[model samples]
Target chain A: MSPTGNRADWADDEDFDDPSVLPPQEVITNKDGTKTVISYRYNDDNKKVKVTRRIKTTVVREHVNPQVAERRKWEKFGLEKGHAAGPSFDTTSVGENIIFRPSVNWKANAKEAEKEGGEKGSMKDQLKDKKVKCRICSGEHFTARCPFKDTMAPVEEGTAAAPGVEAEEDAGGLGAGKSSYVPPHMRKGGAGGGEKMGGRFEKDDLATLRVTNVSELAEENELRDLFERFGRVTRVFLARDRETQRAKGFAFISYADRGDAALACEKVDGFGYRHLILRVEFAKRTT
Target chain B: MRPILLSGHERSLTQIKFNSDGDLLFSVSKDKIVCAWWSANGERLGTYNGHQGAVWTVDVSPNTILLATGSADNTVRLWNVKTGECVKVWEFSTAVKRVSFSPDGNRLLAVTEKRMGFNGTIAVLDISYGENLSAQAAEPTLTIVCEESKATVAGWSFLSKYIIAGHEDGSVSQYDPKSGDQLENVQIHEFDSQITDIQFAPDRLSFITASKDKSAKLLSSRNLAILKTYISDTPLNTASVTPKKEFVILGGGQAAMDVTTTSARQGKFEARFYHKVFEDECGRVRGHFGPLNTIDVHPAGTAYASGGEDGYVRVHHFDKSYFDFMYEVEREQARK
Candidate 1:
């Protein structure tokens, strides 16, 4: 039987019939103007008996919905296949909102610590169960009172003075008063951060060089090769034509080592690369 | 090749951007500080301070002289990169979530969420105007208030003629910068879907959007018709398109709350690269320990940077072998 047109093909099949099952009915009108029909079964119940439709065993075994099957295949490939009208019932009732989904809980550990340990405890006991360290310096102190919190232009001169005095009073000072000085922005109650230790690379490690009269045929690799010997070329952002996606006469080159960058600036500056002069300089550091 | 990781932020990294020159890398975190880095050497420059709240987004002017930041403090601040001082602050009645600079660097676009209503507002300010003015004098040049939806992302189309904003309800609204007239407001995804990011392709004919519904789509910049979809196993938080490689990088992870106990957590933290034409994943990059919040491809297309909930920014460059593979793929597309 054709999978899509199952009813007609199933009706035509004559193999293995069951006597108890009733066939679908058809009505006809005679020339005498009376309607006539033949029936193998009678509706004895006061309520009209309903007819049942059955598919052939072979047809039922072979048919498949391509769309649904294709969706399943994509799911295995790690891609969601279709769009949802809105969030599923589970998400709306549980996930909350986009910024804060039910799946994320950044405050989970902090909440657990507060619930079990209570507020009056030593710094160790207070953060004993917490997953993250102080957000300011990633130090042992509370995020609000982290000593490194003052790194960003101390909000109030008085607060910066307070930390120094507190440091002396607590001989083995733990950074406690730090929490009370939460920055104005952080204290306003959106997503706040804890302090992290200073990161690698200082202000002096950066230098920017420019390539002038770059050939349209020049590729990123060629520019990188020209400066790679001077130092590690971190990035080469080639200005290109929007339409053809070709070099647009100039490119900026950045280096990983300050000394190497400076040397490249002095030596390569005004030098020729593929017959084009290079403009090299310490790109002004954004204060 | 291994990715160069920059560590410093004490909290979740919210956004990262390469300046117009690609010499500087700026990253903002929930920590309330925006740190600048030498993109080439992974050197940390000075941090831009003054926001009293978590900064949501940041952008640099095309001239590379000024930086604009949006924050939950309900203000948009412009800073002189050389001075590290906030040159001007524009206050609003709502939190500013996204900011963008026009190609010409003369205007700044900000998307702000109202304090109480569903409507998000887009304000286009003439940054070239002199600083320090009365509240009335500082009014935006154009304002497009979204109805029944709050914007999550906003930007100026290439050429700076149009302003487009994406909303929490999967609706994208466009406005004529000249008159502030609403031109098109269409639902680009299923209802109740949130737009995570909207980045225009280098060519500007199309833009890509990442949605919380586990799909990233490439749509016509003009009509907003979805041209292609890049679906993923986890809800995508951000996405970026590489101009040269023709690959889309998608990032996300299990919700922070579920990470500790979930058995299938690995898939959530990996950034998958998908072929733009085939929609098939080319490869996966695994490095981030937590959910990735943002990803940005350098204009040169040789490298990309990502920030994550782990409070670290990672910069990945294409190695020789990777470039070879890209060239092979490019040839295949050209032949087709």
Candidate 2:
């Protein structure tokens, strides 16, 4: 009745004959010119009708070409046999000279050379007393076969005059080495002595801050947020005990802007954060 | 009075603004979604999609038919409000931080940061109907290069002729949108602090600026002269003057980066109110548990809304008792 093809459309079917309200039926024709009729009706609950229809159909045999059919059957049988699609290469042949040989050292060992000098005295003292230093660079090697003759080795403070011992006999300027390499920490104006907390500040470390009197409950993100208002904070490091894995009551906050770091240092210094009085300062650069 | 808290954003909210009719509220955040809500009932309407990065600023057209948003994805997007369809996209070389629609809704002004640290280029684009609708790619009508410092906030005047921007160096610059000429550049603060917000007053004759230096200043719109300074104990992230010019509300707190669950529950966030003329503290309202990043006064002057780093928007309406007290205060002042 609602146009959904439900049974409500046939409520008054008695007044007029409606084809929709008629019993569901089907007709089947047999090849022998005989017919069979089947009919069913749906109840109010719309349960499917139990009536069944059966019709026998004729099967037509298809003609096949023997040559094509044989080829297709063979192809299917080959695929079903699980054969590889490509030719396999032979790998059973043994190659020539595949045995691994350990390298033998032809040069004399330093320890053996020292032992050859003598067993009565200390090896280093015996080597020094025997004057077995390299003739080219005053090292412990022969002058003609010295390995460091071409390389640059700075002259140490105590070894400055050692090069003059063989200046005339050795290779030109080989004994007069360049100045000794000095590490940044030992160099002038290095950051070794000015370490802030446990970290060093570099030229670009203007935004880094050293905060003291930090509470153990202070988190890295909390320290970062505390200084973030000054500028964009790039990192926050809370000093912690290695074994205990607990805060060490101090932290470092790094900002992207030097001005922001300086501002945070000035404004947040001596400020109260939680139950602690924060002492904030600029971190010093250390090498 | 109790405030209605709307919580949806997962991260810090960047901005919130009401439509011209004050019926719809649009909010953007670092969560990369632009959400719309019914202002009166606080019911979520829908979200604007298609942005691949954090949306920093949002503005509704004067006609309330379109919305413009700027995002860190280096794009300026325009959306059809009713259909939630992205109508157009304008690409930039850097992240767009702030965006504003003109009074006529025919043009858009945006501040695009060059890379990360301060320094951005101000672009004024004509967004009206043009010949080519083929995802129209049009150059900005005017480009003002901010060389000294990156501007953090920007706004277009009511007349749509002047562009005002605040920089990280606590300086304000006024530019002509037509010729790209800089009309005025003034350093308003002595400490050279980062300018967090800049907005034109409802009167359109003055403007307000908030800075990380723990202060907010009201300046004359014409010559950029300070008329009043509202000082706060903590850093002020945002400030707004009432529509009737009766009160100034400043919102701020301890840095959001430091807010732990314990500290937040202690109620550190607040919005402090001050008398406009006397600059005296009137009262303070506490609700948010995190730093307030943005505050916008209702056009009707009876209510105001704030978005905070705690990912909530709290809309506070003035109570009747406060209105009565303010009336009495005004009457006593008039007798003098």
Q: Show the lowest summed lDDT stretch of 10 residues, model 1 chain B.
A: B128-137
lDDT agreement with native, every candidate: 0.69, 0.71
lDDT of 1: 0.69
Backbone clashes in model 2, listed as residue pairs:
A134-A139, A134-A141, A200-A286, A201-A284, A201-A285, A201-A286, A225-B257, A225-B258, B118-B150, B119-B150
lDDT of 1 by residue, A140-178 (tens): 567676443443223234334544543354432223435
Q: Residues A1-287, candidate 2, lDDT per residue (tens digit)?
A: 23335547566556357544645566878677656667676768976464655655567996544542342222111111242322112201111221111111201242356457565467676667576654333445675565543321221221334334333323333334354554434444333332431232243456678788998878888887788888998777776655677676777777878888889999999999879999998875322
lDDT tens per residue, model 1, B264-287? 235468777787777766666767
Off by over 4 Å in 1: A1-287, B129-137, B258-261, B264-267, B326-329, B332-336
Residues B181-291 of candidate 2 have per-residue lDDT tens digits of 889999997547888888777756787888988889988877788899988767888888888547788888778465455421353477777777666666667667688
Q: What would the TM-score be for candidate 2 when compared with the true structure? A: 0.51
